[model samples]
Target: MKIAIAGAGALGSRFGFMLQQAGNDVTLIDGWKDHVEAIRRNGLNVTINDKTFNVKIPTKYPSEVTADMKMDLIIVFTKSMQLDDMLQNIQAIITDQTSILCLLNGIGHEDIIEKYASKQNIFLGNTMWTASLVGPGHTQSFGDGSISLQNLVDGHASEAKYLAACLSEAGLNAEYTDNIHYSIYRKACVNGTMNGLCTLLDADMAAVGATRMAHKIVTTIVNEFAAVAKHENIDLDTNEIIEHVESCYDPKTIGHHYPSMHQDLIKNHRYTEIDYINGAISRKGQKYGIATPYCDFLTELIHCKEDIVLKNDPVIN
Candidate 1:
């Protein structure tokens, strides 16, 4: 399969390497000039479970794309805010037959992708991998991970199954899910609870759990999300959500990690996916006539923080 990984950051680099290793032709499309230049000069350096190796994959900047370049699949790993722009930039490369899988952290992206491509060409998937960019050409994967994917529309089952098989064959352990929306909301609840709290408190996963207030805040936020999910007919269990949060807090699990949203805030980026996560719940709550005070309050707080950070770092937008 001819694949192009958009964003080509930590996660994209990891996927691109895996596909190349699995004997597929992969090209990394990214806007980071330094990273692309370094990869072209050398190779993509992947560090997994304390071992480092290089994988040879062709790299291209977004500007280098040609209208005639046809890819079998394009895996999107960009931030939510970058989605529209990236789609516009890559418009020339996407054809009706190309499959586009978006593995982003927030909501509403499946519809966005469908606006450009047909329903059969879009795959909704979520992943559990955690990686961070160590350098221009290198990425470090932190833990064992897998992915689940499914078609959001009724008539796209065959496309979803084919993509799932392709991902599993490439060693991603992808599973076909019947209800991907619920799975996505489940992940979002966890991210919305942990990411902002970790950033606001300025602590690692373990440190956040050690505080008594962390439990209260996280539980409150998650409860609001769960209620919203239920109202939307999404199968989300509050107890399960709490357990998932607690499991991530365990030092034996993902204790040492910092949430990606917190990382973006620290870098003074103007945008965070909080809007798509908590804000999504809050918006749905309004429609369903259910009150999501926690989500609304948290979303407002994050946007206020974003405003402050952007004012200080004018270049972050």
Candidate 2:
């Protein structure tokens, strides 16, 4: 299978390495000039569970794609806000036979991707994988994660199943799910809470969980998501979701790790996907007549944090 890892950052690189390991023809599509050059010069440098290695995969800039590059599958890992731009930039490679599996964090990516690919060729999913981009062309990947995905339309179930099977052969822990929305929301709860709170406090999951107000704050934020999910007919169980989220705080899991948002906003001074996570929930809450005070506040604070960091650096976009 010829697959393209769109937005080849940390997690995308990890997926590319795994798929290549399974002997698939893999191409990495990214915009970071330094990172792309590093890979082109010296293969992708990756460390998994303390073991370091390199994988040689073809890399491409979206604009530099060739006419012969029609992809069989495109696994999108672009950041939420940049999805549309990445699609437009890579439009030449996407053909009618191409199936898009969006593994982006947060919500509403299917809406954006629909503008590029037909609904029948689109799939929505989420993953529990974790990785950190150490530098250009280098990534440190750790932890275990699974992917759950579903087709947007029933007519495409066979293609979605084949995609899932192919990914599982690469040891990605991929599963075709009938209720992908629930799985996505389940993962989003983790991002919405751990990613946002950790970035703001400059703490890891354990530190946030150690605080006395953890439950109250988590519940407050989760209630807002649940309310919004209800409007979508997902019927989220707030208490169960809260427990699943708090589990990230356990040291045996991801307790001591700062999430991707922290890596983006604090360490790298890049803008985060707050508008897609907590901020998305907050907006949906308003549309659904649900009060999302916590999400609204968290969104404001994250944006404020972004502004402060950008003001100090004034170079990042």
Global lDDT scores for all candidate models = 0.84, 0.90
TM-score of each: 0.93, 0.97
**For residues 1-317, could you state the per-residue lDDT of candidate 2 as single tens digits?**
99999999989999999999999899999988988999999999999888988978899998898769989999999889889999999888899899999999898889899999989999999998888888889888767888999999887778788889999999999999988999888888889899999999999999999999988899888888888998999988888989999988988767877899998888877889999999889889888888989899999999999888898685664
lDDT of 1 at 167: 88
Give the runs in model 1 whose Cα sits over 4 Å from its true position: 268-270
Error of 1 at 249 (Å): 1.3
Each candidate's clash count: 0, 0
Alpha-carbon lDDT of model 2: 0.90
Q: Pairing residues by index, what is the TM-score of model 2?
A: 0.97
Clashing pairs in 1: none
List residue ranges in candidate 2 displaced over 4 A.
none
